[model samples]
Target: MSKWTERMTDLIKSVGGFAKANKPVAEAFHTLETATRADGILDAKTHELIALAVAVTTRCDGCITAHAAAAKKAGASKAEISAALGTAIALNAGAAYVYSARALEAFEEL
Candidate 1:
């Protein structure tokens, strides 16, 4: 198998084990998954794409890699992936700037 496939398999195994060991965690995962499915606001592919964007913005390497792979499998093209990443970066930058400005105000008041 390819390296990506191997890594994904390992990740799945790890998460599965964790879920099996922790009832609360397992329940939470199930609940979230069910809610996402029931919401139907976005298709699976779109949801995966959104996940990829959020992972990129949050700088979660593992999540980014996994979601990118999932997005590809869900029929997202390279161009789409790139666009999503760009959007994520823009949003992250804006959010950081806003937070930093607020932090500066707080610091000045101290």
Candidate 2:
């Protein structure tokens, strides 16, 4: 299997094990997912694209794999996914810039 395919398979199995170990939390998360999907202005592709961006921002391997698959399933093109990832990269850099200023201020205060 390909690297991402294997990772996704492992993620699925791990999630199942987590659900078995903690049904209530898993159920709650499922409920949240269901609620999010129940009704929303954004189309599936848009939602999945946003999810992919967030996954990149958060540096979550599981989320990246899952959302990449979901985004593809939702008909997000590679260009669209790349654009979303670009936004994530920009946001991370912006966040670092803001935090660096804050760190400098803290150092000055010290």
Candidate 3:
């Protein structure tokens, strides 16, 4: 198998193992999975897009890689993926700017 497929397989196995080993984590996963599967609020495709955005914003390389693949599998086009990544960058930039402003305010007070 290709490296990317191997990595994704490993991630799936790891998460499965974690769920089996930990009750609380398993419950949390179950709840979140259920919510994600729920009708109306967001479809599976949209959820994957949001996940891709979050993975990018948080700089989770493994997650970004996996979720991007998942997004594609869920039928996301290249343009959609690009737009999602752009949104992530914008949000991350805004968050950094806000944090820098807060730090500057604290420095002034000091």
Q: What global local distance difference test value does model 2 have?
A: 0.96
User: Count of backbone clashes for each model?
Assistant: 0, 0, 0
lDDT of 3 by residue, 1-110 (tens): 97878878888888788888997989987798677767768766788899999988887867876787879889999998899889989999999999999999999999
By TM-score, how accurate is candidate 2? 0.97
- List candidate 2 segments past 4 Å from native: none
Of the candidates shown, which would achieve the greatest TM-score relative to the real structure?
2
RMSD of each: 1.9, 0.8, 1.8
Q: Per-residue lDDT for 72 in model 3?
A: 88
Residue 18 C-alpha lDDT in model 2: 100
Clashing pairs in 2: none
Candidate 3 has what TM-score? 0.85
Quickly count the clashes in candidate 1: 0
Please give each candidate's TM-score: 0.84, 0.97, 0.85
Q: Which pairs clash inside model 3? A: none
Candidate 3 lDDT score at position 12: 81
lDDT of 1 by residue, 34-75 (tens): 797697889878888889999877887668768878898899
Error of 1 at 66 (Å): 3.2
Cα displacement (Å) at residue 46, model 2:
0.5
Instruction: Report how far off residue 38 is in candidate 2 (Å).
Output: 2.3
- Specify the highest-lDDT model's number: 2
